[model samples]
Target: MVPQLILVTAFTLYPIVMTHVYSLFEWPGFGPLDRFVGLRNYTRILADELFWNAFQKSFIFMAGTVALQLPLALLIAILLNSERLYGRNVYRTLFFIPVVTTSAVIGIVMRSIFASHDGLVNNGLQLLGLIDRPIRWLAQGDTAMIALILVASWKWLGIKMIMWLAGLQSLPVELYDAAKVDGASFWQTFRHITVPLLVPVGVVVLLFSMVDALTAFDLIFTMTEGGPGFATEFMELYIYRYAFTSFAGGLPQLGYASAAGVFFGVTVFLISLVLSLLARRASQVRR
Candidate 1:
């Protein structure tokens, strides 16, 4: 426990504390940190329309992930958990493969898969006569965001599925037996017993999915570069753009970026706190 605490303090707490401290200064990420701006950076962040736009987009991504990704994963998990299914292990392995792969590498592969005209998806769609011409998935703002969401859903589906599978596996077998004795249909058993029993795990998955959506940067960066004109520019990309990407010899806005990071972190913390309380309540209700 001592070694773990030391590691946490050195790696996680240290960076977070330094991020908050950096937010108070007008540092250019290097050389000097003499200038102090206090709350000016935070104020500037609040006033920045681009930040607000990215905030909205971040929530949009979060909503999409929660609505689409989780359900799909849950369905897959339920299917894989069925005792009647043959080769369930093989299916689980195939699905979980993407979750373990590096997001950047997946993004690179997705870039080619979604490319215009000759791209795999487009070509397949064309062959199927779904459209007369190929859709430019990454060349447009709305479509790029949609593509990002779809890719993210596919990439993360396995993780949430595994979480759901774990929860499903932990459910009391006697409950199912009683449901069977009561002549309850599969849907009835699922709705009355399974759903309520899984609420705690669902809450955990929800929190993680939301945080992942909020901080998703590398894949979007590697794939879209925040382009088709800021279409897929999420909060993470917003911070990276300011912190790392510079234009015309301008210094990086390290202070401003740190402020944004702190803001996002606080937002995540608050949401997680609420969700955690809800999870506790859910567990209480179940018991």
Candidate 2:
């Protein structure tokens, strides 16, 4: 227990504390933390239009992924949960393959698939007579965002389905048996018995999905790199841009990036706290 505690402090707690401390300075990545700017970094971040844009994009991505993934994953889980379903395990493994695959690799492959000319999607659409001209999927702002959301959703869909499956399997067979005996139809059993019973687990899954969506970086970065005039730039990409890349022909602003990181971390913490409270209240109500 002591070793585990020491490791946590050394890795997780230490980095977080240093990040907060770095947020107060005007230091670049390599130099000494001589400049003491106090909360100026935070103030500048709050005032920056780009920062707000990134925040809005992040929020949209989180909402879109959660909205699109959860219900679909739940439905798939329910279907796969049925005992009569043949080759369900194979289907589950196929779905989960995307989850295990590297995000960067997936991003690169998906980018090619959605490329403007002679891409898989464009060729298919042309073959089906859907569009006379190829559409630049990642070159336009709206389409780029839509594509990012969809790819992100697809990448994470399997894990959420697995989580839902776990919750479904944990349900007592007795309630389902009684529902069958009472002549409750499939939809009725699902609505009355399954949905209500799965609320607690659903809350947990929702929280996980929210956090995952908020912190998504690798796939988006590899695919779009926040291009097309910052259309797909989320919070993580925003921080990376300031922290690593030279913005506006200037040096990388580590202090400002740290401030953004701290702010984003706090926002994520608050959201998690709210969801946890909701989960607790839900369980209480269930009892």
Candidate 3:
């Protein structure tokens, strides 16, 4: 037990400590600690316009993921769970494909689809007379963010759907039968029986979605690279730019990047904590 505890601390605590420690210095991930900047790094993050833009954009991303993904996933899972539904396994496998694939590969395909000129989407839209000119999806500010949200939701919806489906499948058949015996309408049974039993799984999925939304980096980084002149700059991309992008000729401000990372980590922590408390309340209510 002690050895396992040690392993957990070594893996998790070490990285966290290092991240916080590194945030204090503008260490360029190299030879020496150039300077102890203290809170200067944090101040820079607050002053940075791009940082603020990314911060606000993250909320948009989070809202979009939750609004569009989870409900759609729940709907799909319910449909799939229906006794009359056919070809359920085939549909499940198809939906799960994107989640199983690497984000990098998905990004490549999405980039092509979203290309400004002669891309599949634009071409199809033009053919249908929806737009006279090809809309620059990844290049436009709102469109770029929307595209990322759509793609991210598409990839993750299946995961949530599968979880909800499992919960639905595992429900006590007796409870449902009793509801039917009592002349409960389909909606009533669903509301009184299904929802209460499913609260635990819903809580789990909510926690996961909150974390996933907050920490979403790979999909945004790959699809948009926070591009089109910082229009879609996410926190991760902002950190990457500060840390890696050579500025004023050669010097890179890696310490600033660590500060940005700290901000992101803090935000995620807060969101997770709030959701956890909310989930507990929700579970208790269902009880």
Separate clash counts for every candidate: 0, 0, 0
**Candidate 3 to truth, TM:** 0.90
Instruction: Evaluate candidate 2 by giving its C-alpha RMSD to the native, one decimal.
Output: 1.4
Cα RMSD of predicted structure 3: 2.4
Better of 1 and 2 by lDDT: 2
Please write out the lDDT profile of model 2 over residues 180-227, one tens digit for every residue. Answer: 999999999999999999999899999999999999999999999987
Report residue 24 deviation for candidate 3 (angstroms).
Answer: 1.1
Residue-wise lDDT of candidate 3 within 109-216, one digit each (tens)? 899998998899899999999999999999888899888888999988889999889889988999988888999998998888888788878888878986887677
What lDDT does each candidate get? 0.90, 0.94, 0.85
Clashing pairs in model 3? none
Instruction: Compare the candidates by lDDT and give the number of the best one.
Output: 2
In TM-score terms, candidate 2 sits at 0.96
Q: For all the candidates, what are their Cα RMSDs to the real structure?
A: 1.6, 1.4, 2.4
Q: Give candidate 1 regions above 4 Å deviation.
A: 1-7
lDDT of 1 by residue, 77-125 (tens): 9989999999999999999998999999989899999999699999999
**Which is the better candidate, 2 or 3, if ranked by lDDT?**
2
